[model samples]
Target: MVVLATKVYVSGDAYERSRDALRSLVDNEIGDLDVEYTIGVREDNFAIVTIEGDDEVVARNVLREAYGEVTPNFEDGETYLGTLESWGEDGIVLDAGRDIEIPADNLGLGQGTPIQIVERFGLVQHMPLRFVYREGDGNAGASELADEERDRLYDWTRGTGRVNVNSATRGEVRATVNRAGHANDIVTVERLGLLEQSIVCKEGTDPPGLLAAIGEYLPAEIRCVIP
Candidate 1:
């Protein structure tokens, strides 16, 4: 069994739709192989995938390559995917099975407190982020966003025409955009987390315009990443 790095925080009908979407995603990734798989969402919101077949090892490797795995223990100098749990004056807490606190000083993005950085980046609660773990005294591990990773995320905002939506499954978001008749405005919807997604706007399309077109149907917080 392999736990997906992404989190699933949606509930009710959206939850069921998200699960079905996840299953289809996994199937698209490794269904051609001689393996049968089952997808389950844990209490902590991580997706657990169990594969059984003679080619299970190959299927497992394929999944690990596509989606980072959620392991119980993390090693120093290695990067892992973690969900944003909470933010405080001191730092941001990530739920990576264990709570990993990233101090404000370690956030090398720019000059700002944790909360300000969260706002500038439009980071949604429960959104998954990549972090590198470092070994500290007593074998405790400290995780922080790498400078390169921070730059990459920052670059996303540098580009105009991206709508960042939170608290809705990818399926729901896509449906809303289509139902709202703004499907052509979007080039693609990138999945940031299970419930957090970024809608990449096509050329000549404004992010705010796309948001306003679909906002009425989504019933979730939608923010624009203006350049």
Candidate 2:
């Protein structure tokens, strides 16, 4: 089964209004599938709605068409948070908020900066509710992919064991590019990591580094290699 993500905006002093809109849209478009909704504060006078569904293609199409009836503001750009250019490749690069500033002592969400929503569309998304891997010897062990890589690399490593990020190792990471009786092209896993990081520029890549192509793709946290 595939899952999809859709965003909805809630209107002023109107949590009820937002809920109604979301319910109506979900009822109409994804009326049949299992639905889970999450609401979070977004800027002023509005909240963000995340609707997750079972079938990705059907869910997205239904939501897009349903906007005509429920919340046209999303289509008219009236409710749009910002254009695509404002978003870096690494999702919404939330630096300091430029528009609003909250007072430190006020005890409320004071003037905060503009909100950037970095919505990543993915299929097999899993959160590490628990981690069991450990280090071996004095040597740092296996490497791991960052949180951001989970979604993009999800499809590639579904049946390929867990995600391994080799950022700490000096030698190359290896993978089989082509196969011949369980043996294929011995590509360095480091190369895959580099590809994922956009460190190397592939053919037809305008920019030299694949990392640059990823646009602001930085590891949220640096993890040492396990021994």
Candidate 3:
């Protein structure tokens, strides 16, 4: 399934006084519905944000439900930052339901630093079952799900080991993959940065030219035979 990159421009007169408040409401509500959000600026009574994931229809429905009239816009492709979780004296905590003792510093969660949730499993539910790391905390959570069971509905709707090479009209592969390729691995030979590269693969695009460029510019480990 192709996951789309989406931007939601939420504007309201209540934004000036409650930027974070509005964001929190939207984030929590949408998150409950399993929509991933990357929070951006909190200014001018408007919020600029980007979201990417599989539950597009559910996300739209939740947005309207929470904001009373949220306008959700969809785009073809994206590099997206997964949701961020932070631990502070008064911030969100991992709802482990049990105290798993560990050094606070090891988790990178002394008191106020937010950490990123890298992996998740189970049917997407209002209560997110996340693999989280605190800034100073040391432990990481991972479990091997039976491949057959993983394919079953018990693991929520999130499926793993899938990829999309199709580019968007903006001339790039999914944003999350594109940026990750540049930052974590040296795939595309970029001059400036991953996000700055002018690349796109939209419907009816020239596949041959793109394949040639990928062969010529990208690293061998990152190369692929476009079927």
Candidate 4:
């Protein structure tokens, strides 16, 4: 079983839809392989995929490549994936089967507290981020956002702009965009996690304006990334 880094925390219909979508995604990821798989979400909200068959190893690796895995151990200086859990004036916490804190100084996003950077990057809660793990004293561990991950967030600012949202599926976000009559204002609805999404705005489109137009239609938290 490989535990996925992303979370599926919403309940009822949302949970079912996310799970169905996730299953379809997984099917597409390993459809060519000779493996049978089943998926489950742990109490911690991390997803686990159990694979069995001749091509299990290959299928598992494919799943890991598509969705980073939550391992039972972390080697010093190695990179891993974690879901954003909470943030404060000090820093942010990631759920990697355990609490992995990336303090403000280590965020590498520049010029602000952790929450400030989160806002600047339009990061929604539950989004998966990559980090390099460092072993610390008394069995404690520390992590910093991986260089590639930091680079990815930095790239967002160079784009037209985006509206980050949480507690909704990609389909729901897209529907909200259409319902608000600003469907043509977006380039795409990018999935950040099972419950997190980014609405990439088109050139000359205003992300804040887009957010205002669709915010009321979504029963979720929304934030804008202005360029």
For all predicted structures, in order, the TM-scores are 0.89, 0.22, 0.21, 0.95
Rank by lDDT, highest first: 4, 1, 3, 2
lDDT of 4 by residue, 76-97 (tens): 8999999999999878899999
What are the per-residue Cα lDDT tens digits for candidate 1 across 1-227? 98987777778887888888888889999999999889998898888999999899999988877877889987889888788889977889888888888888777778888988876776767777888887773224456886676986789777656888877877788888999998888888898876789888887888778878988888677777766
RMSD of every candidate to native, in Å, equals: 2.5, 18.7, 16.1, 1.9
Q: Local error of candidate 1 at 61, Å?
A: 1.6
Candidate 4: regions farther than 4 A off:
137-141
Error of 3 at 33 (Å): 3.4
Instruction: State the lDDT of candidate 3 residue by residue for 1-227, as single tens digits.
Output: 11112222233532232345445655665676655766554222123445667875677556544332212321222111111122332223322222222223333312333222111211111111122222332333322122343233222223221111211211233333454433222233221111112222333334344434454332211212222
Whole-model lDDT values for every prediction: 0.81, 0.27, 0.30, 0.89
Per-candidate total of colliding backbone pairs: 0, 19, 33, 0
In candidate 2, how many Å is residue 55 off?
1.1
What TM-score does model 1 achieve against the real structure? 0.89
